[model samples]
Target: MNLFAEIRALVIQNLEAMQSEGVLPDGLDLGNVTVEPPRDAAHGDMATNAAMVLAKPAGLKPRDIADALAGRLVADDRIVSADVAGPGFLNLRLAPVVWQGVVGDVLAAGTGFGRSDMGQGRKVNVEYVSANPTGPLHVGHTRGAVFGDALASLLDFAGHKVTREYYINDGGAQVDVLARSVYLRYLEAHGQEVAFPDGTYPGDYLIDVGQALKDKVGDTYVGQDEDVWLEDIRNFSTDAMMDLIRSDLKSLGVEMDVFYSEKSLYGTGLIEAAIEDLKSKGLIYEGVLEPPKGKKPEDWEPREQTLFRSTEHGDDVDRPVMKSDGAWTYFAPDIAYHYDKVQRGFDALIDVFGADHGGYVKRMKAAVSALSGGTVPLDIKLCQLVKLYKNGEPFKMSKRAGTFVTLRDVVDQVGPDVTRFVMLTRKNDASLDFDFDKAVEQSRENPVFYVQYAHARVNSVLRKAADAGIDTNATPDLALLDHPAELALAGKLAEWPRLVETAARSNEPHRVAFYLYELAGDFHGLWNKGNDETTLRFIQEDDHAGSVAKIALARAVAIVIAAGLGILGVTPADEMR
Candidate 1:
């Protein structure tokens, strides 16, 4: 149960009672009213802005409403004290039984304790890791992949029907380059000496794809001209690349529910239909874009192109959909892709893109707005670059990738759990410094290890209690948990339900990582305290009843930590070597 929500309901109910008693007006809007944990825990357990938000609307003084609301709230069984504070903020202290019940709730719910219904079963499509299939994913794409996968899991835990998707960039000139690159590799497989031209891929990963082609088609296009082999090789190479990409993602613990093909939009008239819809809405028009403000030259001339009125929604300027030569611009298929998402009947859409694609956000949102008629909402999250370090120096390129650090390089070096956890240690929009050496260090400096240690410590306690013959099945006597350290841990546990809703509302999965770290810190702090105080020890040598109660609390922390890690797609460590 969400204690914060329960208290907020109490406040709302009391305000409704105040309306009946004429202490507040009847038709006041209460949407902005909120109940949350007080910034200073010493002040109280929770605080509400019911009075401050209602004061101006109801034409009543803030203090007057707060005092009346406080009196009514304290009458509830869960509320031990409610005090009106500065500017009519009401701080509430819940009964000890309330904190005590959180342990039972965690045990009862297990991994599902913090799961929320904030999404209300709404369908959400989270499209991420749409890296061009011309090559294996790099470190930059790894962050986006982990972020998107975790976000999908988080949304699912928050009651959203989430669909994880990947958009293939196979319809562009890049894939044509990929086709020619593979043809060269295929020639090399036949023992022909070939030099990779400027635009052809030189990575060794394609060497296998080349051999596979030789095995399948055996001299069919061995010496054919570009026109004869280009089309067949393009399709063949992309399928092989996608297969390699899929394996790479699987290695990193990411699985996509859908892999949408951009090439499919070409032959099916989808791009034309998407643009036609925009044309029907008067959003598409023939226009000449202004030249760059400072770079307008004497020879600069206005060129007419088919543009989408992106500014009408929220973009800085209208964007081109088709070039002056009648070819669809790069933005056309993206628009059609989102339009397809809208047609799929998703209530919301989210795109996780690399930070370099920041410029595309506004226009893409504008397209979704016009296509969905402002009904469905789209949220674009851009993951910034990851700078890698090893031995306190800049890490060099991967030999296998033949260029930058591949996702597999990172995952193989530190394993999937460390890679996923470290990738999320920073906000998506913030640049992350991933140190291969420090990420694996088992110390407080490493957040992933620190958090895992907390889980491991909890398991250690359970093991000790079991060996001591303590009956862990006994119902925990939470009244015995009166120490301040114990209470602090309960307070952290109480924030889970609220934290899940907040993170989901903001669409920030990093917040879950941050919360779990803080929760782990509190749990560890409490465990460390028991090191000096014998009574605080989880396993009492002669007090089996008290030992069971304390073990129950430790297990409760593990339950929440496991649940949080589950949302992050990282497995909890029961034993850390």
Candidate 2:
């Protein structure tokens, strides 16, 4: 059903034939050969670099190879013409029937039209939005959550066995701060006035957690010291915060398959086990690190610490696993967590981190490399900051979150679909400006609206045809779809399968949003063309067969858009309000 793949196979078959006929050399590496859309539509429908890629290897002139290949390519019924462009690039114009067939294929496949098997069922673990379970998620974590969830969906569509995971940062000092904050709230719930110190959380969200604790214990821990209540409250508060986070994610349509607890790695010997695995490979040692660059020797006090030889596995320097006080460093638990992932037998690991964690990438990669013995590949994607603007100024922070806007604030303002689509309109590493006014705007300038309008327009066409009593269920005569605009849309639809494969290979889910925008543009372009020419309209008056064929084409476009939006975790719009 992938026309480009079928055409490429044809080209390869013809090349093999040429080799047998001695028209070309016996062997030429064709791995780099590629077929894609021509840079300019004026050139041709599709373009191939096969001639250019093989010319030097075969010891033949570029034009000479192109000429021979063009003749063999035209012999197929699909390709009508193959013309050589500058320096042996072959531009191909497929027959109208070939483009027409793509519409029928889309109709038959529905939303599954672009699903690919490129991953070949390899197990991939995508860990994202591993924010500290101290409070509800913020705007930064929102971007990471959407990016990771969409990536998991994209991998699944591309045939990978994906596990959506969230790592709870409950083992760190942050949770202790949260427990103390809740304890103050608990005192307030017991009719005691309390002032939150600088180090504790002051958000009103904890007020309920305090009251709930009172409801459960009923004055059991009243006026107790930190030693008696800290442990119990830490566990209790973490569970409450996680519940809030889960509810926030569900509101945004993100659900994780696993919520990994960082506390489990502690007191479980997992950290020691992970470090021992590194020790067995001679990667662990005790040494004093050199003073950081630009630091005067007199100002630096170097301490001997237990370190991992991360430099051997591509990190900039060796990393310390244990602090001078003998407590595990922050990086130790992270290493153990990733080692556990590798031990779970995943073929690949992907971590979605906030932009501030860019410096931590190399060390984490080194840890996974050493733990998996270079077997599992780790790809870390860092999502940059999101700047919110509204009413010609910066958006106000959420009072509930205390310091930043919560994910629920964004979702509540412009439902989940718009929030998800607008978040992905930019690349993960690039900073994004999420303007409240512009996100819900109904104009071509807004990409989410533009794409959704296209789907809604198609539904309108089907509804109108149904009301007119046109038998759309009848087999569509695809041959009647011979207009230039109709064929152009079909050509765009043909690119879907290839687009999915490329996006999945690069681990970029934003490309799906980009492609949906382009597809919508093509569809809207054709829809507008019907205004100038009566014959170009999708529903031809009194011509049932002709209308059915064109309606079939429009339906096909909607199918692919829904499929693309589905991968992005946005529900496709059936009607625009």
Candidate 3:
């Protein structure tokens, strides 16, 4: 149960009571009222700005409203004391039993303790790692993949019908380059020496695709001209690259519900249909764009083109849909793709893009806005670069990937768990430094290790209790968990449900990682505290009931950590090696 929400409801109930009792005026909008954890735990268990927000509205003094509200709040059995702090902030400290209830709640709910229904089953499409199907995914795409996959999981936990999607950039020039590169490899497989030109991919990963093509066709297209092989090879190479990408993602524990082909939008009349939808709304026009800022008029050759009135829907300027040569511009297919998403009847849309695509955000949003007639909202999250370091120096690039580190390169080095956790240790928009040495380090400084150790420690406690013949399955007397350290951990556990809704509302899954770290800190803090205080030790030598209750509290922490880690797509460690 969400104690914060329950307390907020109590505060609202008391405020309405005060209004009826003439302590405050009627009809004050209580929407601004909020009950949250106090900034300082020393202040109280929860703090509310109800008095401060309603004071001016009710034509009453802040302290006067707070005093009246405090008296009414203490009448509830949960709240033991309500003290007014600076101005009109009311800090309420709940009874020990209230915090103790949190442990029992966590044990009962298990990993589902923090799952929320905030999204209310809304259909959401989260499109991420839509990298060009040219080669295996790189480090940049790795961050996007983890962020998007974790976000999809977080949304699902928060009660959204999330669709994990990967939009294949197979219809672009990049795929053509890949086809040519594979063609060169195909010639090499046919015993012909070939040199990769500057425009084609030179990665050794393509050597196998070339050899596979040779195996399939038996050099049928080895000496053929581009006209005969380009189309067939382009399709073949895209399928191969996508297969490699899928394998890379699967290795990292990321699986997409849909792998949408960009080629489907081309030749299927979808682009024209999407543009026509815009045209019907008067958002399409043929016009010459103004020369870009800082460009001299003589240096700029303005071309009249078919444009989408993106400026009407929050973009900086109108965008061209088709070029002067009458070929669809690069953005035309993206518009069609998003239009198709809207037509699929998703209540909301989320796109996880790499940081370089920051400029595309406004225009893509504008397209969805125009296509959905402002009905479906689009949220674009841009994941910044991930810098790899090892042994205090920059990590070397993958030879297989040619010039950059591939996702498999990172996952193979640290395994998927560490890779996933370390990737999310930073915010999506913030640049992350993934140090190979630091990621696997067994220290409090490493969040992944710290959080995992907490889970393993709990498991260790359970195992020790089991060996000692302690009946942990018996109903835990939560009331015995009255120590300050025990209560502090329960207090942290109580924040999970609230934190889940907050993170899902903002579309940030890194917050889950952050919260798990804090929870682990609280747990480890209590575990350490047991060293100096014999009464605080979880496994009481002579008291089975006491040990069971404390172990229950420790088990509760593991439950929430596993739940939080589950949302992050990282498996919890039963024992850290």
lDDT of each: 0.92, 0.94, 0.94
All candidates in order of TM-score, best leading: 3, 2, 1
Give the alpha carbon lDDT tens digit for every residue of 549-575 in model 2.
Answer: 999999999999999999999998999
TM-scores of all predicted structures: 0.98, 0.98, 0.98
Specify the highest-lDDT model's number: 2
> lDDT score of model 1?
0.92
lDDT of 3 at 21: 89
- Give Cα distance to truth, residue 28, candidate 3, Å: 2.7
Residues 1-577, model 3: lDDT tens digits: 8889999999999889888988888889999999999999999999999989998989989999999999989989998999999999999999999989999999899899988888899999999999999888999999999999999999999999999999998888888899999999999998899998898899999999999999999978967889999999998998998899999999999999999999999999999999999999999999999888785777679889999999999999999999999999999999999999999999999999999999999999999999998999999999999999999999999999899999999999999999999989999999999999999999999999999999999999999999999998899999999988889899999999999998999999999999999999999998888899889888999899999999999999999999999999999999988
Off by over 4 Å in 1: 297-299
Pitting candidate 1 against candidate 2, the one with the higher lDDT is: 2
Where is model 2 poorest over a 10-residue stretch in terms of lDDT? 291-300
